[model samples]
Structures are given as structure tokens and as C-alpha cells.
Target: MSDGVKVIAVNRKARHDYAVDETYECGIELLGTEVKSFRDGKISFPDSWAEVINGEVWLRSLRIAENPFSSIFNHDPDRRKKLLLHRDEIKRIARKVDEKGYTLIPLSFYFKKGRVKVELGLCKGKKAYDKRADIRERDIQREVSREFRAKLH
Candidate 1:
């Protein structure tokens, strides 16, 4: 939410299904049409994920819809895009992901300083009970806020 950062898309399902432990800001490689589609917020990443492959991170399942204005050079909507990250950082993330129950997923996509950036989250899968607990907690908080508002008025 800093200056010059414009969020394009967020994967809400990812946050609900997994517990995010850490996040990394990474640059994404994109074609011209893909960038245009992002500017218009025509992207979906419900089931997208990131993986460290051969010492590099690749994002899979991110769909950038075609721009109607673009001609025959449009990029594939489901192309696997490469992520740009420091070598040491990639190694560190790869190490953590190799552990049990840990995985990498894309949290959000945004434009930073006129360039596209991706937010990658290091996450662990949550259990059914855990999700239920989160929902219950949220409801309790909402009730508390409502009661406080009514008391003030």
C-alpha cells in the first residue's frame, strides 16, 4: 500500500485455504499484451502457485485475459511466467518449500514504479478445524464491534 504501488489482483481463496508465514516481493516477466491486461485488471489467480524450479521461481496458473485491442501478438492467457528474485533469496525459499507441509503461492499482483510485481507467500495448508476457528473468531469480532457501536449510540 505504498506510493506508486497499484494492486491488480488478489487471491482471496489462497489466504482462506492456507496460513501465510512470510511474503516476498518479486518481479514478473510479462509480454506487452499481458501487461495491458493487467492494467485493466483482467487477471485471475484463484488456483495459481509459485515453484522453485532449477534454482528459479516460476508462477503457474495465472490467467491474464487477452486484451481486445491487441492484435495477433497476444500472449497466452495461461502461460507460466518466470519470477525475478535474488539468487540467495530463491535458495532460501526453495529450502523452506522442500520441508513438509510448506508451499509457495501467489498472494497478489501489483504495479510498482510502473513495473509489474508479484507478492509470493510462504504458506502451510490449514486444517478444517483451523478454518472453522478463523471464521468463528471473525464473527465474534464483528459482534463485538456491533455491540460497541450500539452502546455508543
Candidate 2:
């Protein structure tokens, strides 16, 4: 088996807004049209999240645009898609989510072995100060890398 998954998109803002504790790769149940839409890069992860219900995980608020050329049928852009995860993993996620200030956010979407997979993160919301600090640290690192490159030139 190869680990070369074709990543579709990553939620860059999710990392900036939340402190991710762990990540889990889970399969997504999608319609044929929805899969085609994703292949065309017509998917958005804005405000998307995972939820454990009835001992199963489900993705909510994911937007996969319809295939405009297909007039006969169209998949809903926003639908609750089921996620394939083990029972123990679901239990662990449920427990983590029940804790105060913890959340389940979608980190990225990708295709692994011809299957659509979503990377879900167990995260805690970051405070305003934390966001500012991250921004400052990123700027400092960017400046250091630039100086290092200039010296090599």
C-alpha cells in the first residue's frame, strides 16, 4: 500500500484558530456526482466539522459543488456525510468532544487508494492572544529564513 494520497485542500485557518491535539484519517461516503465534483476541485471545507452520533462519525457542513454539466442529477452541496472509523476511535473522539472547549474540525481532504479520506483533528479553541502569538512567531521564522537564503546567494 502506498501512502501517496492526493490531497485536495487543507483548512489553513483551522490550524491558525485551533490547537490541534491529534489527527485521524477517515473515509467519507460520497455520491458519484459528489466525488466527481471533488475531482474537479469544487469542494470547500469552510466551517466543516465531524461529530460522533449513535456510535458513528459524521461530517457536517462540507460543501461539494454540483457538476454544472450534469442536468439530470445533482448532489447537494451541503450534506452530512458519514465517516468510516473504528468503534474504539469513535468512542475516544466522543469522549474528547464531550470535554469543555474541545472540538472536532476537518483538517484536510484527500484521496487515498482511490478512496476519499478526510483528516479530522481533535482540537481546542485558541484564545486571541494565542493567535497573535502564532502570527508573531510565523513572521519571525519567515524573516530568519529570508536572511539565511540571502546569505547563501
Candidate 3:
């Protein structure tokens, strides 16, 4: 939302692996060094997921690289980070997660008004056949677009 805010990393695989139904933006609880590392674009969302515990949402498995310039105050690269969200939102997410085969995945990480935020999604795992179908459809669409562009030219 702020002028300086930028998206650092996105989990592109999440869209291919799961069908995301809804998305929510939530703040991340980060240490000083972790924020610095994120600002430097040293973050990964691979294998990162969100879990609801004790009526709160937490981010797990995200890797934030250590700040190279930090002398003595480096945070753990794989520590679980708490996500700040409203109680109603947490409850809704928890309820959805309780359903069979539903999951919460981190889609992307970005900055808003100088604060770090994560885009979380309610997703269901996709089958292998579905992935293949998606690839085929994308190829068809690309070909069609190319043909149309050629005609226009």
C-alpha cells in the first residue's frame, strides 16, 4: 500500500500444486535481522505453510536468510513466524482447514506501509491429472494467442 512497499518473493508452485479458493493478507512477526534479510530479497517461500494453533495463525517452514551485515543479532532462518490477523479471520481459516484435505499455504510475501505482510491462501491439493490438464490448456491458449497475433500483424 505504501510507496516503498514491494513484493519480495512468491510461491509460484503453490498455484500449480493446489487450487486456491481465497486469499488474505496478514502481517508477519519478524525480528530485526530477518526484516533486513527480507528487504535484501533473501527469502524463500518453498515448503512454507500456515497453520492454526490455539486460535492463532502461524507461518511455518519459510526460510529467511540471515543478514550478512549483522554482527551478533541474527535470527534463525527457519523459525516459525506468527501471522497477525483478526480473530474472525483466524476462525474462518481454522474452520476451513479443519475440513478434510484443505490446507493453508503461503502464496507470497510483500511489504505494505513499511511492514512485512504475507498473502495466505485456502487451498486444496490438486491431482496429477489436473496438473497435466492445466499444462495442456495453457499450451493451447498460448498457441491461440500466437495465431491471433500473427493475423493482426
Model 1, position 10, has a per-residue lDDT of 86
lDDT (C-alpha) at residue 2 in model 2: 53
Which residue runs of candidate 1 sit more than 4 Å off their true CA positions? none
Single out the weakest 10-residue window by summed lDDT for candidate 3. Answer: 1-10
Each candidate's number of clashing pairs is 0, 0, 0
Report lDDT per candidate.
Answer: 0.93, 0.90, 0.90
Q: For candidate 3, what is the total of clashing residue pairs?
A: 0
lDDT of 2 by residue, 20-129 (tens): 99999888889999999989989888799888889999889898999998887988888899999888999988988987657899998888888888889999999999
TM-score, predicted candidate 2 vs. hidden true structure: 0.91
Give the candidate order by descending TM-score: 1, 3, 2
* Evaluation by TM-score, superior candidate among 1 and 2: 1
Q: Candidate 3: misplaced stretches above 4 Å?
A: 1-4
**On a 0 to 100 scale, what is the lDDT of residue 1 in model 3?**
48
Query: Comparing 1 and 3 by lDDT, which wins?
Result: 1
**Error at 34, model 1, angstroms:** 0.8
